[model samples]
Target chain A: MNPSAQHQDAEGARLGMWLFLFSELLMFGGLFVVFAVYLQRYPAQFADAGRQLSLFFGTGNTVLLLTSSLTVALAFEALRQNRQRLCQGLLGFTILAAGLFLVNKGLEWHAKFQHDLYPGSQTLRQAPAGQELFFGLYYLTTGLHGLHVIFGGVILSWVLVQVRQGRIIATRPTMLENGALYWHLVDVIWIFIFPLYYLLL
Target chain B: MGKVIQMGEYFRRGFLEPSGKQPALFDWIFSTDHKRIGLLYLYSICTFFAVGATIGLLIRLELIAPGRTIVGPQIYNALFTLHGVIMIFLFIIPGVPAAFGNFLLPLQIGARDVAFPRLNLLSWWLYIFGAIMALSALFGGGGAPDTGWTFYLPFAGETTTNVSLAVFGVFVLGFSSILTGLNFITTIHRMRAPGMTWSRLPLFIWSLYATAWVQVLATPILAITLVLILSERVLGLGLFDAARGGDPLMYQHLFWIYSHPAVYIMVLPPMGVVSEIIPVFARRPIFGYWFVAASSIAIAAAGSLVWGHHMFVSGMSDTAVLVFSLLTFIVAIPSAVKVFNWVATLYGGSIRLDAPMLFALTFVLLFSIGGLTGLILGSAATNVHVHDTHFVVGHFHYTMFGGGGFAFFAALHYWFPKFFGRMYNNRRATWAWGTMVIGFNLLYFSMMVVGMHGMPRRYYDYLPQFTHLNQIATIGSWILALGMALMAVNLLIALRRGQHVGANPWEAATLEWTVASPPPPENFEELPQVSHGPYDLKRAGEA
Candidate 1:
């Protein structure tokens, strides 16, 4: 193929990725629509469930994700400057923060498990039926978010190795740019999930 | 003269060097070329259609008698559910768009391939995998999903069957559809030839653009909605269980939000296809070109807002019902506008009633009937009485079968030359079209009268009062199925005996027609730089 054709193909590839991201937003948006409708249906229970959630961990993960998003953005800048080591280092830090968010999520879910709030548990004998609904949603929303964090961590780690090996370059860093975009989306989803799951107490 | 190579020399290329050995299986498995991948989707979705159609045939066959015939009522419920699920999700929704749209969109727009071809391949694979999962659910401890495709709550959540796996299959299919939509939207925006501006592109491309938008924007809501339904079933969650204080009506709202636009997703591409075929056989440019294109976008935009029409009698507020009913009628205007424009394009023109034109003309007539009937259903009062009756089922088939089905035929006839590089016998083609149009109306139209007389839909049997109409519908289905069988035979026979195709078979001006039939691996020998609108046949000499 012609070199100009290759350039045009690359542009199409980039635009395709952005459109894919837009779809990802809607896929998750479906879950959010359910959340909004359910909130209207069970406003008191949903808010009460939020009060029981650990705001401390939720806030901590939010700040951690926000900072990691900044680091990923900075790594894209470093790659543009051809500072491969700086880019790798920033990507590594971003991965570490994502891992930290996941570990906290695990601890919080475990604490809920210990309290016998998991959906199938029989320990919550008082108001046992509809109460399970609240925890069911909690697991679903946070579990999907956790899946994204794990996916983002894998992608960032790959980008780090690529940056260290001199594969991603200044002008040809679509891989890095897309990875950063994915991480930012993860952070942005958390921005909404935080209020719905933990805040509004 | 040019030293030598004559017409027969060009004709010999498709054979003798036909590459008898399958291009490495990996060529198909990992294909990044859009045309090959499009064929891959066409074949896979055809397999799904066969399965769905087989289920449909059985359901119709069983309904021939008032009582259970070959299968019991329990199995009958599951049969229709699978029929609806497989047909709606696997076949019709992806029918023209993924199969023909993917095959032609890039070529029509003068691009080398889609914006992202690997994702295109992945979408097909995902659809296959989802279909397999859905099919395998039959062997689970309980029978496959007995709840309808909607999987309405209480039935969905409280059912003892393996609804979870079935729902999972639907979710994956929805994901596949969303990805395909994303690819088309990006390709349309970024991959047009240098001079192929949006307004000048073909109407089929415009319809695809609108369908893709809905796929990207609305399909995800269905994904999450099904997920909530699945979890509620598996984990005893109370998301949509009314007894558990969750509103079942919310499920209807969420489901219709995606599924309603989904009707447009199925029809719009075919409408775009008819728009292309009509003018070609009429020997004139399409009338109200902008109106046809705008109608596509308008249908897409208006289609999304009127999902409330589906829930008009599901205990929604009266004001909400009124608003939705009005919007439903408003949405019909664009579809009506498209029908009128196609008719006018045929006016004052020399019309050749070839197979493609026959199907296109049939589309104009049938879609008008379907759209007009949709107006009756859109009224709140009529909807309240006929909410779950055969009337609704008849309305759906009128649009899906009448609009989507006829448009699909129009496309098949229009693009057969390009796809297989051959054309079917025109006489057989015309016969097939005639049988299909008559059989389709007989099958679905009778249901409308039966339903109006108070026969509910989705029932295993009806009262004696509705027996006559039901018998007519059942008999009509046989004719309709026979017509479908005839079409299948004709299409298969065309593969071998159809007329040899040319670079531009119809002499219809479009970027796709500029290339060889069944096009080469790269689509073009040299990329075309466009300078005018696609259908400007008169300007061909100038270009």
Candidate 2:
């Protein structure tokens, strides 16, 4: 007979989380491939479309996401050291940063809407052939990334609740670590998206 | 924690037993037990299969005499589309992996449950949710999509049908598939018993491992592709619209990028099932365990790169066609290696021509025929003639249905007693198998013949010259349906009234056979220690 031992396998849980992150990377990786293919096919049009996107908003969102990622990472570290208050503070900061990023994104999309740059808008219909494709991809890639941001924020908030209840402490911080890992993934995806859309111009 | 539940009580009460304050039905719905979730998948997938099969019968009826004998062209188009979507997405893709893999992975690896049991339950729920969404398109606005399941763009993008909703439904299903893959991969990697090393792992687990990698890596491409299609239909994104400077071929590339590998997702586990069953029935160690295990990985790897083969007639460059055709041929080698090993395993053994064994043998025969014809389709010159004809249709059905579908039947028969604690009538099972084999070949072989005569597919009408073969094929459909009905009835009766059997009824040596029939809620009272290969019949005999 096998040993009658029962304990939570934190390492296995973390490994599963990391594997899930790999899948997330590849999900976005598919979009990146599409972007790369289309960019090669219509270089000038993509460059023009990229320039039309506001560098101010894109850069602001990128900064917010990067800051959030750092805070989430630090939150896990603080929780590991049993500094419950500091961990909660960092998680709250990360959530705030994510909210700000989405707010900035909403404003940027609204400006695009006002200018009729959305796919199927009258302005896009009148634009050059590749320009429509560029904007189409722009909306899809960033829009998908934004959804991830929202999901990451929600996961972090849940983890924050757990920490507040003392359920996720130094000895039991797998949930905290996994949430941070997901938040870092969201940030990392934006790192790629920022360059592809804003800086590529 | 107050009073321990007996193993027999757990089996009898099922995973639907109430926990804490929850009601019984709610317990089943939210149960994280892998066994309950596996049964959930089994019930839903079989229901979908019945729907798909009915649609298939209607298609045959319409084609019974070359011109539409049943439904109108519009309804016909919708029928075939729904049939393809239901079969591919709801049935075959999740078929073996979701049902058998969920039930057996932890059992085979000697674990209490999958690495993420809660996530496993979530996948089953998502499957149900996605199925509902896909079926909703059939009732309201624009009716079911008329675009073939492939949903080739420009047509798919421009169709008035509710392609958007159906495509989005598939997107959700893809998430379910991805989660299942992730759960299985992690379980295999981290949850093996102390002695179940890689070499000592069953071939079925190895095939599942290969299949899981494919599902994780490839399904996202499909998810993204479907999302793009949704954007195109809903927001008029025009990513694949020709007038919008998008190349329609790019959509094909993205789609088959997942879908071509998806063929493996549909078949590899069944191939794994065959690998598991052949040895047990033959009562021998598999002829070449390493070769069979390695070939599953090889097929998975090579299968991904051969997506371009599907796009041969999509007007890609000649060079692209040449490269893809060559890769397609290369992919067949591993499959051929598996067939060779399977036959070798049966070379000189105490062969039992049981229902499960008969089905496995038929799978080997039919899949070989399917794979060989695939070579004709793989060659650019030959494929040009049979590209969208009934030949391609015949070839695909043979491979998927004959190979994957039959292998699933084999697994069901092979593992039925173990999972349900009941023994079905062997005579009726054999009769069902015989009728199916005859009906299957008659149906698909005629399609291949008419295809060679140049009968185009996805049409409501055809020339008089093809009528005879079409009629024959329709007749074949009747037999196939009859066989399927009998098989379902037989298994249903077994579930309720069949004789109870002990564990290891087949005298197999896998870890599952080491536990009770309809295993306890926690799978093993104490995880059995593994000291040898999964098919060590010598050890099985000594024990």
Candidate 3:
């Protein structure tokens, strides 16, 4: 095939990536719908539970993820300009930011665990009915989002290696584009999670 | 053209010839060729079908007498659970699209492969892995899941059986389903031949396109529902636990949301197949081609919202029931439109009673009965009468098995020569088809009658009043099994020793018929430019 054909292939790959992202949005959309229903059913209890979630850590992680998204986007731009060193540095920074976000998430979850707010914990077992439901949704939604963070971090790391090997250059940048798209998705989901879990209080 | 000369070189090499570097096993297992991957799906799905069929036989035998004849209640519950899981998830859901869609989609579209061939292979591997995980539930833990394939919560969460593993396996299978949808959607969008416009595409491709959308959009809800079930079972989460302020009805809402659309996922491709086979064998341009294609999209869209009809008897509010009942009735219109067009296509045409045509005709009749009975179940008042009765079971089987299952057979026989370059014994195939249809009606129609007389489903032992009909149903199952055996044996023999056939054995007008029987690795010697609709028999005759 010719360069135009390869370009068409790249176009199709981007379309496929967008469709995959739609599915990802719906997966989290299911949880958000669940959260909305529960919040309506127990507004006071949800507010209380929301307050218990550490706002400081949530805001900190949000900043980290937003910055990471910026760096990955910049990495893509660097690759487009054929600045390999700049692209690598930006990606490394993105990975570092993702790691810090996860660490902050760990600290927040640890505090919850210390307070015995985990699902099925003895404290949760004795918690008010609506509170139990609130915490349950909490763990399920945030845990799933955290897994995406880890996946996004690992994918960026792989793209970094591919860039170093000259495979993800300006002319052939589909892999880098997809990786950055994934990282942006992770950041976007955290933006939703931060409000629904922490800022709602 | 340059492409034609390149393909001619490949034609000389032959698709089946293994290169010197790789072993045959590695060549096949690791092959990303869409045709080979399709065949892999065929073999695996058929094996799972056999296992599921045997389990169905056991369930029918146990229902033969008033009391247990073949198994205890506990064993019986497990048997039906395994039957439902294997048949629905493993066999029927992926049956037509994965096997035939993978094999024929590229050929029909005049493309060499799907948009993402490697991802296609990954989907198949995930399919196998999910199947293994599901089967593993049978050996370990408190026996296989007795929560039914629906895995209605409370019981699912409370069951000591291997529900979690089985549910997780389904989660994995959902990934495979989603990826296939993503691949097919992209292929249809990007890979059509130079002149193959959207309006000129075959009806099967249109239906697959609609089915692909459903698979991509609706499957995630099922995935999330399964994950919640697993979480509830393992972590004792209160998501669906009524004791913890969670509503069990919410679980039903989420489960049926995906599953009801999933019914379309299972049947639409087969409907597409019937649409393809009917016009060809009837020797006519399809009646209202645009209408038939549009109805497929209509069905897919309307089908998603009518899911709440399944919850009519679950104590939902009356207003909700009324709304759902109206939507359910609306969804039936598109299906009726397709059936009408199919019947109209057969009018005033020179018809051939080939085996595929026979199954297609059977599909129309059986699917109509299924669709008509669906209205009764769709109504709020009538559904209350026959909510969990065997009527529901019979209705679904008629649609899924009678409609979808027969269409699969039709596609199999119709494409056998094209796929394998050999012809099966037509006389034996017809006989098998006759006996199978007879046995199918005798078995399921009886269940509908008995269910009207108040016989519930999933009962290992029934009242003595239902015994005689149950016995008749069991006998029908035996005949059904016999017919299935004959069909399998005939196809196997033909696969190995049947007479060689040339391309275009049926004198059909589809793009697939224009290619060689068992088409080359790259499909076409030259990509044929489309100048007419898929069913333009007059144009085909001139060629």
Candidate 4:
């Protein structure tokens, strides 16, 4: 029984992640302030430009991330029950959900790029003035979230390696709990992003 | 043999008797003990103060005749920038907290140490690293940062100076400040001994608690903002560039978001000092203790939102300016409440006019001037008139120097006996204080008058109408310098010649006074359960 096999440290690790998540929230809060002011100043242009986001892809990514969060939670539960094989299966499902999200995001970005709506591109040079802001925010939010997904994947892989080593067991599932907490935050942020970017229109 | 004799006598006179069980130089550098780290901070900050004061002397000398007598404009710009950078970042930011707060907070609160002692040591080392990097800009391609300490972009980005390194230095410094604040917050939350409830905690801890919040919440914004500026300088990120469709006003927003709360970071610890000092001198429990304590948190919270006030003339929206102006005025209410509480504490009480008390009394007056001028700035109309003028300079000196700096001196004087286990001559201390009081007013007050007469600030030379007042300020600077020199002399002499002090020389009621003058490596023999407020001098006397 490895010391890391117990879930006793889960609460501390989870709380630490939540605190880090709050700081991330505030970091993004600055950009939101800028966007809010700009939106207030150019409401119609913002709405017109926001309407261009592909709701189908946005909704698809949202569902992908939300489902991944459930699988990650179930993985933690499986670890609690000492069901290592099921736990790995659920994490594999969670990683698959992340893969689907990345594919959807790539296609959406490509579509926007084909339409020449990317920032500083000649396509956006002649587009509606507010469209540049739309693209600016679109790229920033999606790029940052994409970075988070990469970070989350790396974290999950570490958890997976720990699982492979028999390190994450019922009594020491803290690492798994912290991973689920982080994945849930990523899902929660996307929940806001989907409606704010794609559904606001 | 001679050195051995001196060391032996030093030990016998209570050096190694009890509190002098501290180790050699190796123990100092490698020690993670909070008290040792605190002493390290005190020595380093005082060195920075001296360096910054030297820069100040150069500026005053240059302003003596107002025609580049001491240096050229380029040199002058660099001088003032160095003064501001060293003083604000190195001196004032860490002034009371790292110096007195570090030394006192845990002992006063009956805690073993800060929650993270290793982090405390790291914060100090990081501060040293940041200081070295900042000073390194002097040897870079351009000599030091000339963008003022604010480092507003466009000027900061394109200002052909060594701003990139300086700003990077500041960014790193911001990290150190954040870590220190974080460490203090965790300590206050988790490290208090049993029965040290929030109400029972000393007001100094409350002030540190409030200051820590600003450090945690506001400093990262500064970190991000400085990083943005650094990227814009090095790699052309357009976060604040006006030409690349970025808003320059955003830089102001980001800078002040940390800086406005930084003012509280500067003032709160001294407010804590005044809280500690007034009760001991008045020989009574502090009146309106809750109000005084709450006002510190109130200032930290309200200070955060009013950063927009700094950008009133920076092309922010009318709505923002209006809102921020209102918020700025509202922010002053808490400071006034603290001031009123201090005065009320002095009322009908047997107030002892010790050197520390005299400085505290002077702080009350000087900070009033600073506060009243702040009201004028808070008004949208009056600010437009004095926004870039010497009046703002005067207001700042009055606030920072008269308010924070003077209170810091008071704390130094108040705690000198406790720190060094010795006492200085009262007569010389009085003389130093008198000259300083007059000299400080002469220097800053003349700046106000010249500022009101439509003279812009930060100029190497002014029009002749301002010449007389500038000359007066120069003269006053000399006087102030003389007084400060006297203070330094008195402290040195006290260290060598003054009478040895008892632990409770001022008859103070705080826990730090209950033990040796400089307590043992472990602060207390046994952690006492605090049963009374820190200012319970009456109870102390009865005991």
What are the C-alpha RMSDs, in order, of all predicted structures?
2.8, 3.1, 3.3, 5.2
User: Each model's TM-score?
Assistant: 0.95, 0.96, 0.97, 0.84
Q: Residues B105-131, candidate 2, lDDT per residue (tens digit)?
A: 988988888888878888999999999
Q: Per-prediction DockQ, in order?
A: 0.53, 0.48, 0.51, 0.13
Q: Using TM-score, give the best candidate's number.
A: 3
lDDT of 2 by residue, A133-188 (tens): 88888899989999998999899999999999999999989999999999989999
Per residue, candidate 3 scores C-alpha lDDT tens digits across B1-543 of 112333253222235556547788777778888888898999999999999999999999899898869799888989999999999999999999999999999989888888888888899999999999998999886898898899999889998999988998999999999999999999999989888999989999999999999999999999989989988988888788888899899899889999999999999999999999999999999999999999999999999999999999888999999999999999899999999999999999999998999999999999999999999999999999998898998899999999999999999999999888789999999999999999999899999988998999888988999988888888999988998899999999998887777778888788888877777777876767877789998766322
Best by the DockQ measure: 1
What ranking of all candidate models by lDDT puts the best one first? 3, 2, 1, 4
Model 3 lDDT tens row, A57-114: 8888888888889989999999999999999999999999988988988888898999
Evaluate residue B265 in candidate 3 and report its C-alpha lDDT on the 0 to 100 scale.
Answer: 96
Error of model 3, residue A163, in angstroms: 0.4
True-vs-predicted CA distance for residue B447, candidate 2, Å: 0.5
CA-based DockQ, model 2: 0.48
- Would you list the C-alpha lDDT of every candidate in the order shown? 0.82, 0.89, 0.89, 0.80
Work out the iRMS of candidate 3: 3.4
lDDT of 1 by residue, B1-543 (tens): 112244444443321123335666655666677777777877887778778878877876676667677888788889888989988888889999999998899889888788767678789889989888888877769887899888888788877777788889989999999989988988898888778888789999999999999998889888888878877876666767665556788788888998999989999998999989988888889899999999999999999999998887779999999999999999988988998898899899898988888888887787788788888889988888888888888888888878887787788888888887878888887887777777787778888888888888887876767767767777787787777788889989988877778878888888888877767666766778788776687764222
Model 3, C-alpha of B32: deviation from truth (Å): 0.5
Model 1: lDDT equals 0.82
